[model samples]
Target: MNRNASRILAALFGVLAVTLPFFAGDYPLQVARNIMMYMALAITWDMLLRSGQISFGIAGLFGIGAYSAILSVIRAGMPAWFSILFAAIFSGVVAFVIGFLILRLRAMYFSIVTLALGEIFRIIIHNLHDFTGGPEGVVIQKGVIFGGNANSLYWLVLAGLAVALAASFWFEKSKIHFALTAIRNNEISAQSSGIDIFRWLLLAFVVTSAIQGLLGGIFVQSYGFATPDAVFSADFTLLPLAMALLGGVYSTTGPIFGAILLGLASEWLKLKIPYGHLVVYGIIIVIVILFMPQGLRQLVRRTSHSADGRSA
Candidate 1:
């Protein structure tokens, strides 16, 4: 679509999103919250993917943030709101330190390390039984944020989604886009062209990790607890990855579209085939990868181009 048309549609969506909880019932709002969380995670995943590095550490950073937020509240006596921000900051700092070491690796080497890191984090949390509540997890004694109000909770998650969207758009529109595209297209060429490849990669990694943590914090605060299995669930990593892939990678709009479709479908599957939903979900993802690897965005674009050619 043209710039003006895109803006108008975005504005309409924004209005609808902001006003959703006001009119919609709690169930719809809850569904929207879940979708927004995964959408944010998917966007963050794509952000890192732009640098030609595939990461499997979404759950690690997410679980870290979840624990950080809850622990800050319970141990440090931090206010619920401040704890969420603490989660983001702590996760960003951790990513910054870890990036220096792992950013040097590329491709599957980097991907494997990231995946291992998530498991390592979970194991560490498991051993810290006294502090982290071990496998049983920790709960917020003060109750959930915003007094467990569904509207407020919906808006909180929406705010996290907005942050992710804004950051992704910024990456897309600014010089970072050129830098990341160059790095992804060719690291050697990007380096020769005076792009600081490592710096750009690190920046993307840190930013995305921080956003994942922020979403995690929001998630834990919304539910009033954090468990290793729950917060660091494979779903946190896999669902977002699948959503990004199914919608289209390397763009902001792709994840949004993917998350909405997959998220709703997932909810329905849970209701219809709760015990085997994930198996069905995995089958769907496999079908998409095999048959529609380029995802809905590319498919739609190709269709539009063909229709235009026919008309012309």
Candidate 2:
């Protein structure tokens, strides 16, 4: 799309997103909050993917954030808003430490370690019965933010997504973009060309982890509960991964669009086949990998190109 078209479309979407709650009911607003959360996750995942890292630890970091917020409020007597900062900080620190150790590994090795680490995280949280409330989990003792208003909660999640979107656009505009593309295409070449491979990789990992963690913070704050099974579920990782793939990896808009479609489908699927919705997600991943590897974004571009060609 041309710059003018892109600007217009962005404005249109922005207006729609901002005014949506005005027209929609509480349920739709709640559904929107979930979609926005995944949209943020998809964008964060895309950031790391741009650096050529396939991390399956979204749930691990996100759950950490969720628990961080929960613990800060319950144990430390902190406010919910401050707990969000605590969540981000705790997750960022963990990401920083882990990135130093695991970022050196490449390809499937890195992915495997990340996947294992996520399970390990869940296990540890599950076992911490005294501290984390174990299998039963804990509920919020405090009141909700915005006085528990649905519209307020909806805007809050939207604000989080906007931050993620800004971070994504920054990655594209800054020098980080070229550095990551270089690392992705050929890390050795990127290193040879004077890119600090470890630095960029660590930066990407830490930033994405922080974002995912903050989203988890929002989740727990919105719902007033957190559990090992619920927060650290495989669904968190797989759903975001599927959304990113379906929308197209390495692009912000792709994930946003993908989340919009899949997020709604997921809610419906949960009602229709609660026991098998994840199977549908698995099937979607398979289909996207096999048939539309470039995802919906590329397909949209192609269709647009064809229309433009015919017009000319």
Candidate 3:
């Protein structure tokens, strides 16, 4: 019964997401796009977390992809559409090269390195004045993809999100799942079990980095510009991390649910308490972490179990 209900809900959501442009206003579509983008990011973050590796470099890789896409279009004369693809490949390659160096670091050591890498990426871009337009950023002379049509732009981001969702689902269902779970549960045990820890961790890092880069490319193409500060904003990392934590980690549905709730709540807070909204938002997140560390998914499961017990 629960499985059937979930399928029905999933189908409804798909229909609504696909048909949103037809009925929703431009503003709503824009907000939906933002939510979807972060939702994708949250899923990718959780993907890596499944390996017990927490990355703080989501913004770094995302920014790399954003800049790569924009620069390819500006300097290399690549098409806007193709540049996004280039971004993903570029980011994946970067992760693959870096993985050998950093994937060996476990726990907070890996997390700190990832965080610093993002800062390093930002600084490099900041100093590249002639080619990258320096800290001021660069704009597409040709303008945004799709001529900035809101619906078209929304769909572009949605497509990126769809890729993220597909990859996440694959991770959850494949042998990769068991590999990561074993690694997370006990790296030593996993190693003894013939699971190459480095290999699986590297794969997760590369795949997640690639998706983050893809999303960044989509963002730049949609907006038609990329600034070091904007593209490398900490929000890219923190918000998605928070969303995944809030929704629950280790599952695709967790991040999606978290993003939807927090994304809408964020907009509402901004409108109602523009000056203090961030403070309130942070407080809310802290409270959730303190009291509901397992997140909404786990909370719902507990509630459902309680109700069943009562009926019994």
Candidate 4:
């Protein structure tokens, strides 16, 4: 019964999202787009996390996508939409190459390397001033991907979110989930059970990186600019990580729930703290880890179980 209610709620939300621009102004639509974009990022993060690997390099691939698409448009004379495809493929290829080298690292070592790589990507872009516009950033001469139409741009981001959601759901339904679960529970057991650990891990990494790159391309094309600081900001890494953690680490619905709640509040928080919002984000992460590591999903389930017990 609760599952039915959740499905109904999701349907209603989808309807509202599709019809939003009819009554809402561009600002509200843009805000919704921002939420959807971050939600996609959070979902992609959790997808790779399912393999028991923690990655802090979302901004790395994201920035790669932004620059790759935009640079292709400018230097290679590709259309903006075509550049998005190139961005995804390029990011996936980079991930595939990098995964071969780094996936062998265990636990926090892998995490720390990813964090370093995010900054490394940023530094490389910052130094390539001749083509990339360096730290000053590049302003694309191209118009927005959807001709700057609020409704179209909103739908474009929504489509990307839909794809991420579909992929997450598909992952949940596939044997890959079991393999990843076994891996997360015990790599030795998984290996003994015949799981090719490195192959699955590499697949997850490449797929998630591609999705992140896809979103980044859409973002840069829509916004009409990309700078190293803007694209590779720690906010990209931290906020999505927070949303995924707050929502739920191993489920599709958790990140969606977290992103909507926190993404909405984040703008206000940034305004209030200005220079100190990252501190607030850090505090939230620490609190969630200490008090509710399973996140709001666990809380919801407990409430539902308690109500059932009371009725019984």
Provide the global lDDT of candidate 4 against the true structure: 0.89
> What TM-score quantifies how close candidate 2 is to the native fold?
0.94
> CA lDDT of 33 in candidate 3?
97
lDDT of 1 by residue, 234-304 (tens): 89999999999998899998898899889999999999988687887788789889988868777777766
Number of colliding residue pairs in each model = 0, 0, 0, 0
Which 10 consecutive residues of model 4 have the lowest summed lDDT? 303-312
The C-alpha stretches of model 1 lying farther than 4 A from their native spots are 1-10, 310-312
- lDDT tens digits, residue span 1-312, model 3: 254665686678789889999999998998999999999999999999999999999999999999999999999999999999999999999999999999999999999999999999999999989999998999999899999999899999999999999999999999999999999999999999999999999999999999999999999999999999999999999889889989888999889888988899988888988857668657767977898887887777777767777431
Candidate with best lDDT? 3
What TM-scores do the predictions have? 0.96, 0.94, 0.97, 0.96
**Model 3, TM vs. native:** 0.97
- The order of the candidates by TM-score, greatest first, is 3, 1, 4, 2
Decoy 4 TM-score against native = 0.96
Shift in Å, residue 311, candidate 1: 11
Candidate 4 per-residue lDDT, tens place, 175-272, comes to: 98998899999999999999999999999999999989998899998898899999998878889999999987998988988998888787778778
**Clash pairs, model 2 backbone:** none
**What does each candidate score in C-alpha RMSD?**
1.8, 2.0, 1.7, 1.8
